[model samples]
Target chain A: MPQQVTRLLIVFAVFIGMFLVAAAFLKPASFGEYGHYRGNAIKEIAAKEIKFVDRKSCANCHNDNSDALAGAEHALINCQTCHGPGYKHNQWFEQNKSRFMRQDPASGIWTVDTILVRAAKDIPEEYKLLKPNERDACLKCHAINAARREKVVRQIDVTDHYDVKKKCVECHPPHAPNS
Target chain B: MDPNYQHLYDALSKVEGYIYPNEIGLNWGILIVLYPYITGLVAGAFILASLNRVFKVKALRPIYEISLLTSFSFLCVATMPLIAHLGQPLRFYEMMITPHLTSAMAIFAFVYLWYLMAVLLLEIWFDYRKDMVIWSGEKKGVLRLIYKVLTLGVYDTSPKSVAVDERLGYIITVVGIPSAFLLHGYVGFIFGSLKANPWWSSVIMPVVFLFSAMVSGIALVLFIYMIISWIRKQKLDMKCLDSIGKFLFYILIFDFVLELLDTVHRVYTAEESFDIISILMTKLFFTLTIGQLLLGTFIPLLVLGYFQFSKPKDAIRKASYFIISILVLGGIFCMRWNVVIGGQLFSKSFMGFTTYKARLLGAEGLLSSIVIMIIPCLILAALLWLLPPWKKKNMEAY
Candidate 1:
């Protein structure tokens, strides 16, 4: 090769070599083990703990709340859907059951911790249960949009809906929405 | 509320029709518009430069180096808008490495690098290598260091070495023509291939984009050529300016026709999305009809077309060319704006529309887009300082 050609070839070779080295080292550990994707991604996703504690678990403790929810418009909906993830909620309650009970065993009265429920959005990030009472909390799903079909979601014309001053929860019981 | 989204909230209240809450914020803002516009200039400028080298168009000889540097300067900053627009710019290398093979977007990193490293950089190096070596020896201090480093230790200015440089540069230019086409055509494909978006999806989108790139690129170089001559106090080369204007005129017509054809097809077919698109047209009346059509296409076409027949005075011709070049550049920018911003104006449902008001602040705002546009010119200014393409004092030294 001519002197210049040799130098150009070396430059090309250096780029190719760098690319090969980067390709080798910069990959995910499970990449290309099965196909073009990461082979272990499925196992990683499958191993994740469930966040939505379903109705059966909630029914064990709150019989009255479960009774109110049963056979209502929201009967099919997950309680955690509106209240945020319940894994932490159930775990917190399960672990701290004695904190809710009275000092006397016979006294069945229950009171929540004074530290909790001090503010409107008092529920911390650790325990994910929430009490959403705002108009937008309901309007997110219920507000009329061209994208939403009437059959799929009972769309409401928020402009014409009764009392913008009042929230959806003020008129209808959230658990048993017979209205 | 996050203070950054105050603009989006402001836009939301002004929205004429109902939009999905998600659609209230345009995911692709003005920064996205600049992405294609900048890249189009690169493709267009490279193709213009290649006309001189590969096709052996002698009239275009004057602006070849300038065109290459313009293309290079713009190309350097081409990815800024894209990276800045990205929600996570730190992980941009993810697109370079382990890209999703199926996506048109994922291929951009490779295409850009190939054009930059393989085509433009190589060709420019081969062209300027001889000059750099000479400049390194003559100069002293920090400037000497720059020129020395630029030469990459290649000091050969012999007849045989010069021949090799010429042959290699010619080959790269020939390859670069298609690569330039691919670079901008692929930019169009980024939007065009979206089956879900009726506004963007088209069979001729790449062709339209390529032609528009040519239009914008030629116009930009012509404008710069005039300005450079004025700055250097040299008599303008009328032959080169006239030829560039001719090419810009032809390309603008082609670009306009393709856009018209696309719109006519949509109007005649009266597809389900036509209703929404028609509404969108009314909303973008100023940008599409006035800015792109009236100022960008028609005015330049008339001015350049007039010059084709009549031998107007040199002063008049130069003035008209200057104005025409600016008009064509603005029109091409509006064309990109119409495609990117207009596509998102209407909801996917085809029953509602949203408005985009480019704000004066934040990374995703109009001010940043202006800054991004200015960066290329700043780069070009610095490049012009380092390697002035003007004829030097030692003309026959080589």
Candidate 2:
């Protein structure tokens, strides 16, 4: 009888300990500051800030991209969220404008010519941030199957999509989005 | 593509050539089939054992011990399919440790445990205690040690102890009847309760499963009884053979009637899934109707019924029993195939049809099932070797 009682007591104590610990964790995790923010969309947005270049600046140069943005589902998404900042593009123009002046006039844009002509230069390899393999850059917001998103989509090795080998911008020209 | 043609083409194009459920291949269907097949064996074996214990049919006396051993053996292997089915096999203990009471699956774990430990294991232990004690005392080395552990310090082989064991065994046999029924019947209930699947959703499923379990159980015991008697060169138990044949006749009739009623109800209702199901019956599963139901169930019924009524000579009776046993076993396997594969044959969108082909040795395939089924028989063989039932001496060795 004593052994049975002792066993019962131990079981009871263990259950009580578990219940109290769960209560302690649950009250704060669910009802307190953390839980309060979990309900707030604004807080969630603020927590995951987008490193976006001002869209108005991109519009000054590329009006077609601005027009395409108005019709797309990704219109609400900021530009630099997909493509990194315009600071490097600005720097490239500054360095290559002299080379651009000597390009043939009958040929289309000097952007292509200048790249081919000045292909051999001391460009920092890291500054060319064209990663076609990273799907998280696009899937950050576009979740098709939300239930299994993390398990299925998030971990999908994106390099397998050979079409987007140079990143999403290959098909979706970021600066000149419509073209 | 034309609009109507495109829809048909798209559905056809989505069908994987040899693979199934394309996401996880054919594991799901394989698991579903094996789950009920193993459970049916448990239900059938238990019901066979119950005949001698509960119904007090003395002709079934030869099979009573074998039936108990069969039930116990089958019960041990029954959970292997479910474990193999699990996505995370190692986490199976969660079914016991922190079960979700609301889920049908969670309830099944408790139900299986109740049947295993409380009913099957307990009854087998009580029935075999006397024999185990004597075997233990006679054995010399490792077998003696194994027997000692199995006996669990209970050495009392007095008449009082024997009487107590017998009473407990009898009590367990009574309790096991409902547990045995629930073991397989609940599997039917699981399918029947799924209102979404038109093929599975019928009120008659549980009743069908229960009657069929009895049919298969009786047939299996009859098969084993004949085999064991042949091995020992002993005369076949005529009374036992007759009783089994009669019981098989009644249960098969009950099973056939219920199955017929289920099919009739489905056709009468003429629900949305009727056309595809009709195709399944006549076109896709023509063998199931002509081969399994007609040639297997109906003809065997006639054969067994004729033999039982005629009181045939020993050789004729034995031949009929063997044929009937084969037919009943084949019929039951086909029934499982119909339930598992037949339900899935209809398109989820209620559009068209699909086919199922069982793989031979995939991870969750026939190899696993064959291994699981054989393991129990191997265990039973070891058990028989340890304690030979036909020993001549009556010494209290323990």
- lDDT top scorer: 1
- In the range B1-398, model 2's lDDT, one tens digit per residue, is 22533443444444532222322223256666767776787788788778888888877777777777766776787788888878898767656655566778778988998898778877877777777788789888998988877766577788877777778789988999988888889888888887878888888888888887777777777887777778768778788888888888888888889988888988899988887678767644554886568766999988877875687678888898887788887778777777877777665556555555667886577787778768877866665566554551331220
Which residue window of length 10 is worst by lDDT in model 1 chain B? B389-398
Candidate 2 Cα outliers beyond 4 Å, as residue runs: A1-179, B1-27, B387-398
Native contact fraction, candidates in order:
0.24, 0.00
TM agreement with the true structure for every prediction: 0.87, 0.70
How many residue pairs clash per model?
0, 1
Tens digits of lDDT, candidate 1, B312-369:
9999999999988888899989999999999988888777877788888998888898
Which one wins on TM-score? 1
TM-score of chain B of 2: 0.89
Candidate 1 RMSD to the correct structure: 5.2
